[model samples]
Target: MSIFKKVSESERNTKATIFVGNIDPKVNEIMLYELFIQFGKIKSLNLPKDRISKTHQGFGFIEFKTEADLKYVVQIMKGIRLYGKLLRVKQAENKSNDTKSVSNKPRTVDIGAKLFIKNLNPLIDEKYLEDTFSTFGEIISTSVDREANGESKGQGFVVFNDFTSSDNAIKNINGKILMNSKVVVTYAYKDDKQKTKHGDKVERLLATNAKKHKMLDSSTQPTKKQKR
Candidate 1:
């Protein structure tokens, strides 16, 4: 018999999920699979993609067979650069904010020059998005949503430096054929005040927690009197 014990498919997915971010656009499913499999058996690997266009969303999730394996990957993979971008690996966010679950989606309140797009072609990537949209004006950024398996989610966002260009893009490109698919483009809604408030709260919370941790660590250290 082989030295390694065989694990069932269900058993492989019982542990923590790792959220990987700042992914290089060029990275693909095969590369990620090969790299992560070295640490442990993966239950599921998802790279969120645009729903319509089906392009990599520059982030993904990897579910391991055990918590130990998941933690090991996060610890060792920190600051590891691949394809010219440093990866950010951490525990996956709980499903509380999942679009389907959130009754009042916060994204609907967003106000900016950014455009929300849907029904993108699977073959299209970020560069293609920029190139195609740049004709209207300078693009601030472009992103395509992808799923865990690195497949396109058929939706994405593009931000322009100014509203004029954004308006032009919406007028000129909305409902246009892109790579054999008709795309829907509209203003991306955002709530800047709420977002900023939330950001400040998070920062304060992290700082407070860090201070508490430091105090606890220092208090637990052995002193000269104890050593004597």
Candidate 2:
């Protein structure tokens, strides 16, 4: 008997979805179905393809008939080697709820309070990124850049309530590794004005350091008053 035949329409309506990333280009939908069906009945599978190449994108989404089945697959398949590449599997985001929540919120913009992060691991989602930087200050927002099909672009932004928090995050979190990927963090400039302001801030910090160094050098010099 076909495994999908046992799943009813109602069960399909409440299907739990999972995102599978780092998929080998050679693996097709048929291969995925054949491999995953052994765990449970699958309601649907979507492997987005490139428009020109028509090859499956390096990621896909799978909807299972039940949450338990989806969890089991995620637990078993995560980090599993397929075609010599480790798979990245996790629960898919509920985009509809996220969109609704964001649309209902009042927008507040703060200049010089956002940090740009680059070279993030594919497994590092928005929640994980936010939690890692939350020790510095209250975060206003966090976002991970993604393609239309939801593959990570390996970069993100963290917006804090104030400039101090953002600066602190850049100083501490930059050059740190998370999930085996070293990230680069810097000020996210929205316009020319912000860029100029950031340049001024850097100049001021350099001037201060130079002045301190000069003072220390002068203090270490020997006095010539004994010759008089």
Candidate 3:
């Protein structure tokens, strides 16, 4: 009976998730699982392969059955050098944009790259968000955040290739409210923005990091707190 209690407690506290970063383009699911398995029991390994390109998406998710393993990897490995690159392993983004594709049911305006949206609905599934946006434009992409249960974290990115379509989308539905959630629209920048805010010294550091941080691009805008 004591052993059973111990096992149940272990199961509850041992579960956690990590967003594996700085993956070598050549790395595959099996290698990743083997590498992280050292941390603890792996609940799942999700590496998105581009359906069109059938290549690695450069990032993947690793889930552990317990919080101990998850917390251990997130802290000790968050900035540890892996494969000559500094891996940004941390708790996955709680909120992300998810894409929904809608082939039918056109809207009054087209949504293009001009407008950007953030602050998403956690309960709304990714497909639901994509379908809503598809009514506006030819979507570029929708990024939805997920947890172990594969539930939305309630924030995501929506991009359109055309500016006018974005403007038309804003005019028609900026504040109409969908999915029982209000949306905020703004312009989005690359992750490089963070480096510029502190100073040249910091920017140089960030640039150097970008060399190994395959997750971030050279032009990514930094977070607001990092702004100059």
Candidate 4:
């Protein structure tokens, strides 16, 4: 009969994803860290960047070392005032299944070089992006921006396992996509440290937002009184 009984116990309770919006444009994840780390041990923190200006949109994700940490933070963060926005915190998304594609995760075999990809469509995702580039070389990793809720920023990074492969990808992909106006691919350094924080930020920001969503049960449809 507990109010939260319907909230099933999560298996991986330690990690969480949080959403952040209504943020102060000037505030970044580093500033958020200073505020949220008070709850527990923080393993990782991310502040997804705005595709246009590379600035944060006042939201990001934080991962603590244990579930107790996650719960503690949620309890402490709800309705808490910081950056002029009442923070919404909750469990992070489980993207582990989506990451199973070997083409996506960090390639242990270093490519000894990085390549920049250009002309990507704003609608594509990290996996699809990798496939387009994989034909040219062994890709070590990839990232598409989580801009505007769920759109790519027409930019990304693809790290090859070898310089020859990287060179080959550039030679083949550069002008080919341009044929139909898809995008022209270019060999460039894979986006390095920048991605780490932002990816985490995007994931958390989304998860946090989801938690605050309002749901209506059809069987118990609200009456005028309930509506009020």
Query: What TM-score do all the candidates reach, one by one?
Result: 0.40, 0.40, 0.37, 0.38
Tens digit of per-residue lDDT, candidate 1, span 63-159: 8778899889999997566654456677665433322111111121111356778999988766578778767754435666777655668887775
Model 2's number of clashes is 0
lDDT of each: 0.59, 0.61, 0.49, 0.48
For residues 1-228, what per-residue lDDT tens digits would candidate 2 score against the true structure? 243242332444433777676566568887888888898888787666543335654566678889999889989996565554446677765533321221111122222356788999988876687689878765545667676656678887776544556667888988999899999998776554654433236633543454366522232122221000
Candidate 4 lDDT over 1-228, as tens digits, reads 121121222533335534343344456666777777777766566655533335553345566677787777777776554433334455665444322343322112322335555566665655575677667655545655445445545666665544555556666776565324456555452244442322233433443343334221121121221100
Q: Give the TM-score of candidate 1.
A: 0.40
- What's the lDDT for residue 225 in model 1? 22
Clashes of each: 34, 0, 34, 12
Give the C-alpha lDDT of model 3: 0.49
Q: Which stretches of candidate 3 lie over 4 Å from their true place?
A: 1-15, 95-228
User: Rank by lDDT, descending?
Assistant: 2, 1, 3, 4
